[model samples]
Target chain A: MTDATPTFERSPDLPPPASTVGVVGWLRQNLFSTWYNTLLTILALWIVWEAVPPVISWAFLTADWAGTSRDDCTSGGACWVFIKEWFGQFIYGRYPIEERWRINFGSIILIVCAATLFFPRFPYKLWVSLFLIFVYPIVAFFLFSGDAFGLEWVETPLWGGLFLTLVIAIVGCVFALPIGIVLALGRRSDMPAVRAVCVAFIELWRGVPLITVLFMASVMFPLFVPEGLTFDKLLRALIGIMLFQAAYLAEVIRGGLQAIPRGQYEGAQALGLSYWKMMILIILPQALKLVIPGIVNSFIALLKDTTLVLIIGLFDFLGMIQAAGTNPDWLGFAVEGYVFAAFVFWVLCFGISRYSLHLERKLHTGH
Target chain B: MAVSSEVGTPPARASFWNDPRIRAIIFQILILGGIILFGIYIVNNTLVNMESRGISSGFDFMGRTAGFDIGMTLIPYDEASSYGRAFFVSLLNTLLVSAIGIFFATILGFIVGIARLSNNWLVSKLAEVYIEIIRNIPLLLQIFFWYFAVLRALPSPRQSFELADTFFLNLRGLFVPKPIFEAGFSAILISFLIGLVAVVFIARWAKRRREATGQQFHTVYVSIGILVGLPFLAGLVTGFPLSWDYPALKGFNFQGGMTLIPELVALTIALSVYTASFIAEVVRSGIQAVSHGQTEAAGSLGLRPGPTLRLVIIPQALRVIIPPLTNQYLNLTKNSSLAAAIAYPDLVLVFAGTALMQTGQAVEIIAITMAVYLTISLVISAIMNWYNKKMALVER
Candidate 1:
């Protein structure tokens, strides 16, 4: 009936495919394979539900959304009115009330420039970046603390909050990079004198914590240099932070430099490239490329470290939150304020990290 | 090359301006001059400023006695103590926190790393959530949260949570019973150490034998047996001399016990959680670096997953993981300095803050603090590097 007798192969084809291959199968295998996993999943969901509802309710529902006064809050939920009232102080610290518009304008300028740099579709990114790198500081300085151009001077002591955080992080990144590169090079240098000095300097900074360095900058740094030749407190702290951060940055860069094939340097030399030319055009371009993710991670770390300046009495983002939360009017909002600051910091740091991962995949040449 | 062997003579074709040696010498002279000038200017200006301010600065403050109170002290401390003693107490506190953080961070990191690679979706996601959240936020903020929001909110000493009548948990700290060892306990300790030495020797001997003869030896089991059994046996033979000093509830608070201050707890927890994220990545990457074929081959030989993991995968993975993990440990230690933010009397807070303020000896104090960290860091790196070299796969 069916070609007489079979060829004696049992089931012939392979056994039926197991139910653990595609999305549904993966869900079954991973999420519900064991009673334990299912239990864990349920527990996790329950935790999320429990935490999120209270948080949402506290932050939004039964909350004071509006009004100019502290009296608006009834306290069942987050008194957003507190955040609203102190929003200016959070943004500009003690920046002169009327003059605060300058920061807004400056932020707008930077935002437009940043849009050019961050979003790939924008044209003339080169010019925009260059403008951002060089010109923005001048405009921001004049607008923010202008004594020149007939605007009243805003002292740095009064200049703080989120603005300070942005300023420090940007300055730290920029100042740290070149100094870090030099230190990294000096560490790897053949010259005994240069190498020894750099080794001493980098190790000295990296060994201690940033908070101590900030303390030194605030109190002791004055004693190090000539007394009459004083730097602004913020400026001194900035320098200290730059130096300390540069030490770490230098080590990271050194790792990248070491990772590059030795032949790359020799090859550049073979092509008769000068030391600077070789570094700028050949060696660094490759070495830096390989270390982009590492560099981003370090930058994220620096951003987080900026909050430490609160110890030195600078009202950076965290400082702003602390000051506001501790004020007599909003005595019990410590949790809310910290959580808010945490959320902002989380968004920024997480964005950079995710972008770095994307870049890792995108720029991956699989050397 | 032999042509350049002419002693004390420049090459015949050398130009004065283009001479590498001369250029180097000139640059060095310029740098030296700049540094010297800068140093002199600073010194002279500082002296003038000091005179103008009518302030005389010296280390005289140290001998005058430190007029401050340190809440927790591992040493005998009083108002009569010198500033030096106070600084030491703080430094010890810092070391204690760093040590504890490194230990816990490593354990949590390993667990989370393994979890990240788990077939179970929920576990992996949880690990991811822990890492991404902790790593992104500033450590300072986390410390602040633990100190200000969490710890500060706990009930006062009056309503302190009691456990077993020997401990108390309040906003202040966790009070647990401390062991008071009898003088004769030294005999037990000495014997325990001897047991450790013997176990190490046995391990080495067993390893050599196994290598030479291709025979399996249960070294781990034997070592564990020696570690625990020998210690217990010694203690029993030495009259079982250790006893617990249970903290009595006295007045409003627990009188005496091993108190873990809230600041210390917060700092250690923050450090552990933050560094664990980095360590998790390191562990994950290291395990992933091993080739699938190695595991597959071992499996085909009828070896189980546990044996295959240990004999084939972990050995190779460790070579990759150890280097990065060491870096994370170093980072955790360094990050512990942030304890100053929450006023946890670590080296930075105590010496860098209180001591430096008293001494006004910025250079000396900073140099000392830096040196301590440098010593700790170098020791750790040196040990880890040596271990990494030893564990590196010896490939054909």
Candidate 2:
């Protein structure tokens, strides 16, 4: 064994070859990996080249950005001057000029409340959120539909544009969430009768288009109500929207509920907890947390559906644009008005969707 | 041990009031009672309201003349037509738009979906940006943008932009050469149908042959040849039974071609673009759900990338893709109701809007429109469910 012993050789380490490292290597691996991929890269570059320059020129350099009238739009580009001129109408839509401050105040309150509730590390957020949910609507109602506090009464008919869109979307979402939770629970209840009723409610709403629902609310709801007693148009539309959205949200929550293991329910029962107590303490929190992404998705859907209010003769954000577009003064500026509306809608919806995706990532602990 | 002992000992029975069963029954009874009362009240009030307001409610109004014009109807419609005919026309139009949208959206979605997974950084990023931009915006907003901004921005009929000699784009809509089938066309049509059947049989035989023996066939090229070449041969033998009607400027506007109205084009384009984004996401997720091990395993077997993808990955990816794809189709169909906004004369606009307006039967008209949509949706879902079951892996 001693005679067969051999010495081992060691080589000093060298730097990685340039072909497998650095920016050039990344380009080789990701962009120019194959012949077809290079072609694809060139094609994509062509598309961007064709699209971006025109958009830039139209949106920025050649755009009529700060003009009061159509005459100012002399460039062969987007007439952004239309948007600027009718910005107030786009925001408040026939809301009395003197009383516009009320909408501003409402917006401020909403922003402040949202900032406080959603921002992480805020103290007592849960309680504050609950308080806002339960009480803020009352405050907002009084503020927007002001008959109290010596303020002038602003009718819902005057409630148009972005303000009205937020009003419907926010109220629809706020009401839909709790109702959806209840419906979901009822659907999964041990009681067959409750389950049947909830199923019927959910299915009926899900089966029909929201436009039909809005039509029914606007026209048929009057027939349902007692004679000489009327419901506010916005309130009726809100009711229809809430019921419609609740069905979708209920399904989302039910997905979460079904995902929970059976052992959780059994364990809660073994702990001698009542159904409500079991749900509250051991089930619902987990289920709701699991479904936060789904809930937000449904909320985004509800926000979009809010635009359907236009059919019922309500002037939501989109409706306001249509109205402004048809104005004799703003005639031929439909392109600009619609583009502006799309941008606003795109921004809000995109931001919310991104936030929801972020939340999903953060909350995904992989049960 | 204490808990087990407690469980072992029979617990004292609670009073009936405290019993969950009795309480549930009582609760259910109360709910039933409330619902019944509410229903009766609504019915009574509605009847009284209808009577006082002079609003008639029945299917009888469906027979009355529509006395309204519906733009862009697939079926022939006029003021003299009954409400039922108008409904049918609008329903057909809705189905037509939906079918076209679904077809285009599926193709675009697959392209975008595959592009999102491309090795090329620029291609993937471009696809990602497209999906993100499209999916984030509301469908209604997109529809408006297409209808008002894009379509309306087109030049008038007199100054139409030419897409080749056969197609033209103008403010009124897209003017495309219309196909006109002359005498002896049935032979070509029959051959086409025969070719389709042949292709189906060939595909089945190919599958069986491949399964039984490791043999391959150029079934795709054969199928294409049979389907298209047979039709062309039949047409040639029948003295070319297909002719085209091209639009030419007559008087002030283009005449004699099939005009896809701006509304239909706008609706179809918007729906396809919006729904494609969702379908792309579904496709991306479905493909990703196919484990890398499957691809690596296929590679280890010396299978080429294309064959591995076609045989190994797609079968598995399809299971994940289909349910969500069906959902997007349903969404696209439902979103077609937005056509009412632009007066596209879809089911909602013609039947729910014009028909309801003329008849003033809100409940019946709305009910009929809803039932139509519900039936369409249910049928789609049933077909999708059947496909899903077929695609699902069989387990012992």
- For residues A246-313, write the lDDT of model 1, one tens digit per residue: 89888888888998899989999999887789889987888788788988988998999999898888
Question: How would you encode candidate 1's per-residue C-alpha lDDT over B189-302 as one tens digit per residue?
Answer: 887899889998998999899999988889889889888898788888888999998877678777776889999888888888888888998999999999899999999999
> For model 2, what is the alpha-carbon lDDT of residue A32?
88
Candidate 1 fnat reads 0.66
lDDT of each: 0.84, 0.89
Tell me the spans in candidate 1 whose CA falls farther than 4 Å from its real position.
A1-24, A34-77, A119-123, A259-267, A365-367, B1-12, B43-64, B162-167
Tens-digit lDDT track of model 2 for B1-396 = 678876796778999899988999999999989999999999999898888889987788878887887777676778898988998999998899999999999999999999999878889899999998888777888888899878988988889999777798999899999999888999999999999999999999999999999799999999989999999999889899788999987877889889999999999999999999999999999999999999999999999999999999999999999999999998899889999988898988888887777778887888788888888888999999999999999898
List each candidate's DockQ score: 0.58, 0.73
Model 1: what is its DockQ?
Answer: 0.58
Cα TM-score per model:
0.91, 0.94
